[model samples]
Target: MTAPPAFPAPHPSPLDLGGRTALVTGAAGGIGRACALRLADAGAKVRAVDRDAGGLEALAEEAHGLAGAVEPHVLDLTDLDAAELAAVGTDVLVNNAGLQLVRPIEEFPPDAFHTVLTVMLEAPFRLIRGALPHMYGQGWGRIVNVSSVHGLRASAYKSAYVAAKHGLEGLSKTAALEGAPHGVTSNCVNPAYVRTPLVERQIADQARTHGIPEERVLSEVLLQDSAVKRLIEPEEVAEAVAYLCGPQASFVTGTSLVLDGGWTAH
Candidate 1:
């Protein structure tokens, strides 16, 4: 076989998205909030979408003085049509909204499973469907799905979350293939357990599921498989999302940018 093409030299200028519009779901807080701010810092007009009106307000306030503005758009991704509509006229899309329930499959609530799948998997598809028109029209777009280690590897008590993320991984790749010719790229940022409100909320559920105290849950459960033995910061994962949207990643599509603290190394 012929040798692969040589990698190009790094660009000198920093990432600059002066007039682009970006929509980040779950922008109320955590990885999504960090992503909204990071993209705004790169001069992208960020539409921060989430169900938490107050949290979105706080995020908007925090993003003041950035290179670009953060416009809070209160949205519930489970509203599929609204989710798609909210993504209209956008350049970049970050699918990060999610819910988790730690319970055995036999004990899992069917409604909760459906909700997790809807928020984590189906909503991303709708958002992509909405964003594609504008992105295809402009001949450029970035779709970053904030997945997790659970997307790649399963855990005992997180059937719904694991299944949803795995499905997200597949959806991301499919988008990449279909959008490649249109100059749009789709990729997943698979981070390990992150230090966010979501994780904090899950601590109790995990504790109950694993029969461990809340205090021991972090070390014995969440970080057990991670070589780093610590939760990843939301900003760290956000930086990965920013990188995927930068010029450096124009050809980097249909891939998992795993930031799993070596959880998948095994």
Candidate 2:
């Protein structure tokens, strides 16, 4: 409801983050893991947060030789207070953690819907709140929300995911307006279907819901609307996040960078 006192300065290099601190949620796997690695590659001190301690450990191991370092912080985003606390002092924040459940509105479980919204929408809000002060003080920050095509367009049986992403898109734009005066840019990267463990796991759920074979879910359901006809890679989505964090995108804010492989074009 209230805004922070803000303006950030400038960095010359597009991908250099020599002394920056970045907090990436859902960093244990999927888009989160890729983003952590990408930010660290740019010399950021990355605080990788996720409930998966094992995955975070493996991520740390994989980031051993990067230009920056990955500090694994195991925390479930459902703990709103802790999620906010964990975001303190971050220069950049990537809100990418999410879960999906496929079912008709009549059949959808309320608990699952609540969990999805809490993690995807509520946690991001807390993280942003925690990070704003430091960003405002320093006069420069980037907030990248890894949204989805569903943020702009809806599909059947993905009510929770759609609602959460749409809410995130609005939140991102509002942050952009409020934080712009303080040298912070907020934006959403709307990727279509992505190749990740989460998406892979959803294949079966989707198949069951659609009464289709698991093998056909990808071609018939997920990619049906995408002109690209393929699932986006996690690294590709991370690159978009990196760009938004870079010098080139300093002027780019309050926007949804749609990378839906022409899905929206149609």
Count of clashing residue pairs in every prediction: 0, 4
**Which residues of candidate 2, in runs, are more than 4 Å off?**
1-14
Please provide, for model 2 over 32-69, each residue's C-alpha lDDT reduced to its tens digit, 9 standing for 90 to 100.
99999999989999999999999999999999999999
Give per-model TM-scores: 0.94, 0.94
The ten-residue window of minimal lDDT in model 2 covers: 1-10
lDDT of 1 by residue, 235-257 (tens): 78888898999989999999999
Q: What's the TM for model 2?
A: 0.94
Q: Candidate 2 lDDT (Cα, whole model)? A: 0.92
